[model samples]
Target chain A: GDSVTQKEGLVTLTEGLPVMLNCTYQTIYSNAFLFWYVHYLNESPRLLLKSSTDNKRTEHQGFHATLHKSSSSFHLQKSSAQLSDSALYYCALSDRYGSSGNKLIFGIGTLLSVKP
Target chain B: EAAVTQSPRNKVTVTGGNVTLSCRQTNSHNYMYWYRQDTGHGLRLIHYSYGAGNLQIGDVPDGYKATRTTQEDFFLLLELASPSQTSLYFCASSSNSQNTLYFGAGTRLSVL
Candidate 1:
């Protein structure tokens, strides 16, 4: 069975500060895909970034996440956090190559609070 | 932009009642999924469909039923709703394996 973990339940940061949300996973499949999703209040979560290549950084909307197979982690990072970046972030894993229809296993989610 | 819409933005039903959550995607995505969000469990897959007339059990499929009538529509049914079923429900659609998912505004369901 595959599982994802996001240790931080909430992270508060001031605007313009650096940000990082830790995500780790445990799985048996090779060449797994990792994903980042953001959700606002009362809204469904949307894909923000995705990657499978280990050590390759994927970036979008000023945020970046590099999948590290060695560490079994795909932590999301931002050079500068903004107020608009406040939302719930989830880390997901999938074994698309295994004929599982790419079923996803998501983390508990990290609530990011960026303040001015 | 890809659009996935869900009906009945909010619902309140009594215990042991029937509840249905409808979802539609205009992007002709082959994969559709249903997930439930709770305070502790961020989100867990309830059921999914690969294509029209295809259904699959997910991580948690105990108290739910699903139907895929057409390529564009997927419905989740809760025949014997319990207080534990009170949570936010989300529907998402994806085109293929390992593709991005577009989610609809979640529906808030409260079982009293």
Candidate 2:
């Protein structure tokens, strides 16, 4: 079985502050694909960043994450946070080659609130 | 852009009632999925289909049954709903199992 964990259920920060949302995963397979999906209020959840290669930082919309196979983690980080960045972030794992085909396992999600 | 549309943005039904959530993807993707969002639980996969007439059980499929009648259409059925079934449901489609998923606006279901 595969699973994702997001330890921080809520992370509030001031505008312009650094943003770091923790994410870790566990799977029996050696090769893993991790993803970050952002969900805004009243909007459909969309992909923000996806792991390209292990240890290679993948970034989009000022957010970046690196998949560390050694630690089984793909933590999302931003140098500065904006009020618009406030949303629910989910870390997920793609079990493409698993017995059940390509299924995505998501964490509990972290609500990132940025205040001015 | 990929588009996934779900009907009945809000639904309310009593326990033991029958409910069906519909989804259609114009992207013509081979894979479609049904997920439920709950507080402290994030999004949990209920069921998915890769193509017409195909159905695969997901992490939380105990109270759900899914049908893929066409390549663009997928449906989630709750024959006998329960209170615990109340949640926000999202439908998504991807070109393949490994690609990025495009989600629908979501349906909020309340089982009283």
Over B1-112, each residue of candidate 1 has an lDDT whose tens digit, in order, gives: 8899998999999999999999999988899999999876898999999999999998889999999999999999999999999999999988774467789998999999
Q: After superposition, which runs of candidate 2 have C-alpha atoms over 4 Å from their true positions?
A: A97-100
Worst 10 residues of 2 chain A by lDDT: A94-103
TM-score of chain B of 1: 0.97
Each model's fraction of native contacts: 0.50, 0.56
Isolated chain B TM-score per model: 0.97, 0.97
Residue B28 miss distance in model 1 (angstroms) = 0.8
Candidate 2 achieves a global lDDT of: 0.93
RMSD of 1: 1.4
Off by over 4 Å in 1: A97-100
Residue A42 shift from truth in candidate 1, angstroms: 3.0
